[model samples]
Target: MSAPIQLRPDETFLLNVGPQHPATHGVLRVKMQMDGEYIVKAETVLGYVHRMHEKMGENRTYAQYLPNLSRLDYLGALGYTHGHVLAIERAAGIEVPERAEYIRAITVELNRVASHLFWFGAFVMDLGGFSPLMYAIQDREHILDMLEAVTGARLTYCYYRFGGLYNDVDDDFIEAAKRFIPRMRKSLKKYDALVSGNIIFQKRLEGIAPVSAEMCRKYGATGPVARGSGINFDVRKNEPYSVYPEFDFDVPVYHECDSLARYKVRMDEMEQSLRIIEQGLEKLPDGPIMVEKKPKTIKLPVGDYYQAVETARGSFGIRIVSDGDKNAYRLKLRSPTYSNMHLFDEACEGMLIMDALAFMGSLDLVIPEIDR
Candidate 1:
C-alpha cells in the first residue's frame, strides 16, 4: 500500500480526475487533494478496465489463451505476446527455429516503433500540441501495413505461436519493412522540427514534476520513465533475450528526469528500434519459422515458469504455474504500466494538476495493461 497523503484540515479540497478525462487516455481515475490549482498529493484508483485476463489465462489452454496477450498493451502487443510465448517455450523446452527468433526480433521492434509513434502524438497532444498526431499516424501506417501483411491484424495481433510465428514473412514483407526505415528516419526529422524544439513544448515540460531515479526505483519504474532518470537498463541489453543479443543497438538515457527527458528517451528509442529491424532483415537466415515435429499435446512440466520482455511501456513479465496440464494452474501478469503509474502519487505531489498530468503522459501508460 502507498503511504497516505497528508491533507491540511481545511485548506485542501478533493478533486477527481477521470474515469473519463481525455488526458488520461483511458478508463482510469486519480483522487487528488488540491490547494486551489496546486495538488497536495494523489491516490491512483484502478479497476475500471479490468477484464480478468489472468483468470482467463487460467481457464483456457495455452494456445487458446495466446490471443489474450495482445489485448494487454495493444499498441505494443507483439512485445506482450513475446513474453508469454517465451515463457511456454522455456517451460516445455520447445526449440524455436533460428529464423523464428530473427523474425520475432524484427516484428517486436517494429511494434515498438509503432507504439512510440502513437505515444509521441498522444503525449504532445496532452500538452496541447495537435499537429504531431497527424504526422505520427502517417508514419505509423507504414509499419501497420508491413506488420499486417504477415500478421493479418493491425492492432491486436495473435501472430506469434508457442514455438514460432503463425506464419513466415514473405519477400514482399521484407521489402516493405526495408523501405519504411528511411522514410521513418525522414519523418522523425520532420517531427523534431515540428515538436521537439517548440518553445511552448519545452517550457511546459522542462522542469515540471521531475521524478528522481530513487523515486523510479522505489516504484519499480522501467522503460522511458527509468531511462529518463539516467538508469541505463533495458531488458534487450541488461537481460538479453531472443535475437536481441544478436543485434546492435543503443539504449537512450537522459538525466533530466522530467517530462521532456522522457519524451527524448522514447524519440531516440524509435531510432534504435529501426537499427534492430535493419540488422534483423540483413542477417535473417533461410530456415523454418516454426519448430519441426512439435508435440501434439501442449502440456507443460509441473513447475513454475516465468519470462520477461521489454515492451514499449517497459518490462512486461509473465509467470505461470503448470500442473502438467494444457492450461496454466495459475498465471500472473506483471505489467510495467502498473508500477510506473503508481509513482504518480509520490512524484507529482505539489505540482499543478496540469503539470502532474504532463508527468503521467510521460510514463506512456496503457491503462488496459495496468487494469489487467
Candidate 2:
C-alpha cells in the first residue's frame, strides 16, 4: 500500500500534522516531508498513550482483565469487549443464554451507531464544517441516554460478562429502545438533508482521496475503509458471530472508493444498525440472561483462543494464550486502525496537505487502539 518516497531533498521541508492537530482526533503525529505545499513523504508517529493493554491482560486473571478491553477503542468499546468475552467464553466452554446474545447484539449495535454519530460530527468538523457537530451530538445524546439507563455507563461500557451481560435490561429500557428506532430514523433523514447533499461538503470529500480494493487488501484494511473500495466483508455477516447470524441486514458497500464513499458507508451503517436493533427487539426471547449452571471460577484449558467482532472503526480481535491458570500467558490484540493508518503514507503522497487530512478523516481512526 506504499510506494518509494521520491524525496526532493533541496525543495522539500518537514512538517508535523498532528500531536495537537484537531484533524487527528487524538495525539497522533504525522511527519510529512513537504515539497512546497504537496507532500513528498509521510510517516505516522504513534505511542502517545502508553496504555499496555496486552501486558495488562497477561497480568490479570481472565475475568479481572475485562475492564481494560473497554478502553482500547473507547468509541467502539462494547465490540472490543465483546471479542474479549467471547474468546473467554469459548475457551471456558461456557454457554450464554439466547436472550443474552440478542442483548449483546442490540447493545453493541447501539454502540456502533453512537460511534458513527460522533465520527460524523468530528469528521465534518475536521474538514472545517462546525454545525454538524452540534446536530450530531444532539442526536447522539438520545442513544447515550438509553445506553446509560441499561449499561449504567456510557462511553467505555464494561457491560458484557464472560457468558452474558452485566444485568438484564428493564422494561423501561426496552420501550425507550423501541421508541429510539423511529426517532433515530427521523434524525438520520435530517442529517442527510442537512449535510449529505451540501455542495461544500460533497466538494470537500468526493473524489478527494481514492482507495483501491487492491490497496486495502494489501494493507489488510477492513470495515468502511475496505468496503468503500468494494470489498464485500463484514465480521457480523462474513464471520457470523454471536446472534448476528439470526439478524438480517446488508453490509453497506460503495464502489466509489473515495472519502465520500467511506462517509456514506458509515451513515448507511447507522440505519442498518437500527434495523438490527428493531429485529433484536422483536425476536428478543424470554429467558435468564446468564447461564443457570454458572461456575464460580473461570479457568481456560491450556491452549490458544481467539475471537473477532466488528466495531465501529473496524474488526477488533482478541487472542489469549492460557496455561490452565487464572492469568493468561499471553494476550494479543488485532486492531483495525493500525492497518488502516498504514494506508496514510501511500494515500497522502503527492496530495495537498488539506486533502491528505480529509483522507485521514475518511479512515475513521481511533488512535488509542493503535497505541495498544
Candidate 3:
C-alpha cells in the first residue's frame, strides 16, 4: 500500500489501482480520485520498470541496441525491432532485399496476431471473464511456436538485423503458418460467440468511456484507439513501409468511439493481419534474405533519421541522430502506448472505476512500451 492521501469530509478520496494489479496489464499504477464509485480524476504514474532504452541506444553500438527494442514491448517486439532496423537502414542507405521484406512482413504480422490474441484474453480476464483467456492463450501458443522456430525466441525477439532478417523462413515454417491461419479464423468466430456476444461483457463495455476523434488527435493517439473513434489512418496504409505497399488489406475503423468500438477495431485488425500474411506468403519472391556487401559497423549520415511501423498496439517510431559513428549520438522512441495512455486522464473522468479499467483495456497498453 502507498501512503494514504489526506482527505476532507466531503472531498473525493484517492485510490491507488496498482503497481502490481493484474487488471493494469503490466507494472502500472493509476492514482484515481473517487467519489463513491465514480472517478473524479485519474493520473498514470509510470517509471516502475524503466530500463533507459533510449540511453541504451546512445551508449551501445547500433547492432547492440537490437535486443533493447524487444524489451520495450515484448508482446510486439518484432515491430519495434523492425522500426529500429528501418531507421538504421534509411540512415545508412542500405537496401533490403525483396524476399527479406516479404519475410519481415509475414513474421511481423504473425507477431501482431499473437500480441492481439494475448490482449484479447487478458482484457477479458480483467473483466472477470476467465474462459476466454484460456481460449485466447491456447490459440496464441501456436503463434509463439511458429515465431520461435524462425526467431529462436518465444518472446522479446530480436530476429531482424539492420539490413534484413537474421534468418530465412524455411518450408516447415511456411507450412506451419499456412495451417495456423485457418485455425485462427475459426478461433475468431468462437471468440465472437463467447465474448463479443456475451450480454455481461457488452454491458460492461458499450458506450463506457467513449473517446472522441478530437480527443485522439489532441493526444496523438493512433492504432485502434484512433481508429475506434472513426479516424481512418494506419501507418501501414497512410505511410507505407517495407512491402506493405505491395499487399492489399483494409484498415479497420469504427465510428462509435466507445470501448466496444475500440474492441471491435482490434478484433477486425487481426483478420486483416491474416490477410497480409497470406498475401506475403503468396508473393514471396526467391532471393537472399540478407543484403551482401553491407558494412560490418553501421555508420549513419550526420543527421536525424526516423522510421515508424504499425505495431499491434499502435505506431512505434525510432528516431536516431547520428554523427557518422557506429553508435547513435542521440536516440528517441515515440511509443504509441504513451500517446494512447495520456487520453485516459480526460476519458476516464466521471466514469465508474470498473468502466475506467475497461477503457484502459481497450487502449491495449503495454507498459514497458510507455515507460521506455
lDDT comparing candidate 2 with the true structure? 0.90
Candidate 3 structure quality by residue, lDDT tens digits, 1-372: 122434443878999998999889889999998977778789999999888989999999999998999999989888989999988888888999999989999999999999999999989988899999999999989999999999999998989998888888899999999999899999999999999999999988888888999999999999999999999999999999999999999999999999999999999999999999999888999999889986798888799888999999888888888898889999999999999999999988777888888889989999988998
Clashing pairs in 2: none
Model 2 residue runs over 4 Å out of place are: 1-8
Model 3, poorest ten-residue lDDT window? 1-10
Q: Taking the tens digit of each residue's C-alpha lDDT, what string does model 2 give over 1-372?
A: 233556578989999978987889898999999987789789999999858989998889877888898899988788898899899998898999999999999999998998999999999888888998898888889888989999888887889888788899999989999998998899899889989988988988888788999999999999999999999899999888899988889999999999999999999999999999999999999999998877677888999888888989887788889999889999999999999999999988888888898899889988898998
Which runs of model 1 end up more than 4 angstroms from their true locations? 1-8
Return the number of clashes found in candidate 2: 0
lDDT of 3 at 15: 98
Better of 2 and 3 by lDDT: 3
